[model samples]
Target chain A: MRNEFHADLQTVSQLLVELAQEVRAAMRQATRALLTADRRAAEAVIAGDRDIDHRYRDVEERVCELLARQAPVASDLRAMITALHVAADLERMGDLADHVAKTALRRHPSPAVPAELRPVFTDMAGVADRMAEKIATVLASPDAELAAELDRDDDAMDELHKGLFGVVLGADWPYGVETAIDATLLGRFYERFADHAVNAGEHVVYLITGHPTPS
Target chain B: MRNEFHADLQTVSQLLVELAQEVRAAMRQATRALLTADRRAAEAVIAGDRDIDHRYRDVEERVCELLARQAPVASDLRAMITALHVAADLERMGDLADHVAKTALRRHPSPAVPAELRPVFTDMAGVADRMAEKIATVLASPDAELAAELDRDDDAMDELHKGLFGVVLGADWPYGVETAIDATLLGRFYERFADHAVNAGEHVVYLITGHPTPS
Candidate 1:
């Protein structure tokens, strides 16, 4: 019975890693859609979110089943609980990516981001993609050191987000209200995506070290 | 042993209700601060969030402890797991309210909503406060009927959120880029607050009826 429980725990970890991979693809595609005005890509990201949600519910049910059957204690209990949170964060990241896709869809044909601000968004998309990849890596291994590194990586995204504000509120601002709203919301989507990745990393760190990292 | 487990479950329920009440107060004060630009009220709301987080962690730890020790199954297991999700939603609502308060602080001595949009924000604040109060009531009783009503109540906030987009994106928008960005973010904060309230309501509905509401 103990071996069986450990096997189930391993399955849970594998499921989370798979979900992380899906989230990374969605985010990458969503960023590409946003930057290039690819309607098909945007639609695909929006449609793909259903799959992520399904995976999230699956992970959740499995966690509950494990708790009910094995009644895991101590570190084992924490692992199961942390899995629930990590899945939730990944699901939320998927949703944020979908939001970005919807923005692209809404402004179809004409890109939502202005040409001048394109570089900032491009940089943001790159950072967000890297963060998602790192999230997947850390989830698979649950390394405390690697998890802390994810937090530091997220700081770059935050700086990029702040720089967006400077461009929008600067004296030379040329975009109209509509574009301003779009840029602000778009920046937020990427920033929040990174934030959730950091959150998942913190959960991983907690699972490994038993020390909860403050968001 | 069964009686003791049931008693612990009751304590979990009571703790959740108490946390819901605190969330309601924080949201209410935060709204008031945003509309009135009350720095003191905003500061109070910001400071008060730590307490909410503490309560949330307390509830979570207790639930984990119960699951590990009692190995609750069937309805009992479902209730404890649902409690975790509901507490998380309440904590997020508190964070949204804090975001609103920070917006007020950022624009201190001057309201975040322009004079023309004040009435709209006033209506939103009123609706959000009412929703929080209803959430507390439904959580205390776990009534599926009351839980369903919260969704309809949220429709009004959604309408308000849509109306904000129309106002901001309208050709007659006289606000500058900074103000437009502020208005957009502020509108989203309120909309998301109501959305989280609805999510909490859905959790209550599930707890009572065992039917998961579509998120």
Candidate 2:
């Protein structure tokens, strides 16, 4: 019975790792759709989110069942709790991707953002993509060091976000009212995406260290 | 042992109610600080958020401890889970209040938004305050009817948010970029606050009826 319990634990951990990968892909696809102005790709991201959500519910149910049957202790308990949290974060990340995809669809016909702002968004997109990937790495390994590095990546994302907002707000731009709203929402989407990545990193640290960072 | 378990459960429920009150107060105080351009009031909101955070964490720890100790079954289990979720929503609501306070501080003195748009904000603030209070009531009593009423309040807040964004984005305002960004972020804060309130209301219904609303 004990051996079977460990086997189930291993299975749940592997599933969490896979869920993180799916979440990472969803984010990447959504970012690519935003940067390249591809309606088809954006639609795909929106559709794919349903699968992610379904998978998350599946993991949640399985984890709860494991807890009821196995009654995991110590590190095993932490692993189950961490799986529950990471599933929620990954689902939220998928929602963020859907937000980006929806924004991309809204701005499709002629590129809603100004030409000059494209580079800033390109950089922002890169930061978001990297953050998603790093979150996956941290989840897979549960390494305290990777979690710390994810914080640095989050800082870079914040800096880019600040720069983007400054350009939109402080600089003179000719993008009309509609375009400006799109740009603003897009920047917010990226900022929120990075925030969730930071949250995932924090969860990883909590799982390994048993303590969350000071607020 | 069972009596102590019941006592702890009552404590959890009582704290959850108090958390809802603190969250509502935080939202109202933060928005009032913004509308009045009171920097000191905004600072107060910022300081008060720490207490809200502490309360939420305290409630969460208490609920988790109860679950670990008593291993509640059936309705009790549902109630505990609902309390856990309500705490999370309340915590996120507090974060939104903090964001609004920060926005207020950034736009102080010069008043980045147009005086004309003040009424829109005023309307949004009123709706948000009402939503928070109504949700708090529903959470305390676990009333499906009141929860449904809170959902209706969300509609009013949504309408105000949409109108404000339309006005801000439809025309070229004289305040330049700060006004637009401020308006956008302020609209986001109210929208997200309303969203969380709606989520809390749903949880209340779930706790009472044993089924959350359909997504």
Candidate 3:
């Protein structure tokens, strides 16, 4: 029975990793849709979110079943609980990507991001994609050091988010209120996406070290 | 042993209700600070959030301990899981209020909501307060009907959120970029706060009826 419990725990961990990978892909495609005005890509990301949601529910139910059947304690209990939290973070990340995609769809045929701000958003997207990839790695390996590194990656995203504010708030701003609103919302979506990745990474660190990471 | 487990579950529920009340008060004070530029109120809300976080952690640990020790199944398991989800939503609501308070703090003595948009924001705050109060009631009683009413209340908030977009996107928008950014972000914080309240309500409904509510 102990061996079976351990095997179930391993399966739950693998499922969470798989969910993280799907979320990473969703963010990548959503970013592409936002930057390039690709309606098809945006639609794909929005549609793909249901699959991520389904996977999240599956992993959650599995974890609950494991807890009920095995009643894991100490480190084993922590692992099960952490899996639930990580899955939630990944699901929220997927939703953020969907928000980005919806923005792309709303402004279809005309990119949501203006050309002048494209470079900044491109950089933001790059940072977010890297953060998501690192989250997947941390979930799979559970390395405290590597998980800590993801926080530094998130700092870069924050800088980019602030840079966006500078552009919008500058005296030279030429975009109308509509564009300003779009830019503000889009920047927030990316910043929040990176934040959730950092959260998932921190959970990984906690699961490994049994100590909480600073938010 | 069964009686002890049930008693622990009751304690956890009470803790969540208490957290909900605290979150409601935080939102009310934060909104006041934003509209009136009350620095002291803003500071108080910001400082008060730590207590909310502590309560959230307390509730989370209690639920985790209950699950590990009791191994609750069926309705009992669902109630425990719902409590975890509800506590998370409450914690997030507190953070949203904190965000609003920080926005107020950053623009001290210079109210974040412009005079022209004050009425709209005032209305938004009213809806948010109502929603929060209703969430507390639903948490205490777990009535599916009351929980369903929270969704209609959220509809009011959505209208206000869209009204904000209309004002910002209109040709008559006179505010500069900075104010526009502040308004947009503030509007989003309020909308999201209400959304989380609705989520907590839905979780209550789920807890009572064993059926998922529409997202």
* Per-prediction TM-score: 0.98, 0.94, 0.98
Candidate rank order under DockQ: 1, 3, 2
In terms of TM-score, how similar is model 2 to the real structure? 0.94
Clashing pairs in 3: none
Of candidate 1 chain B, the 10-residue stretch with the lowest lDDT total is B138-147
Ranking by TM-score: 3, 1, 2
Off by over 4 Å in 1: none
What local lDDT score does residue A36 receive in model 3, on the 0 to 100 scale?
92
- Cα lDDT tens digits for candidate 2, A16-67: 7777788778777887777788888889999999998898888877876776
Segments in model 3 whose C-alpha atoms lie over 4 Å from true places: none
lDDT of 2 by residue, B82-155 (tens): 77778878888999999998888887865545787899888888888888888777765667888888777888
iRMSD, per candidate, in listed order: 0.9, 2.6, 1.2
Better of 1 and 2 by DockQ: 1
Which model, 1 or 2, shows the larger lDDT?
1
Q: Residue-wise lDDT of candidate 3 within B54-127, one digit each (tens)? A: 99989989988988788888789888888988999999999999999999999998888888788888999899
Shift of residue A51 alpha carbon in model 1, Å: 0.2
In model 1 chain A, where is the ten-residue run with the lowest total lDDT?
A138-147
Candidate 1 iRMS, in Å?
0.9
DockQ of 1: 0.81
* Listed models, DockQ each: 0.81, 0.42, 0.74
lDDT of 2: 0.79
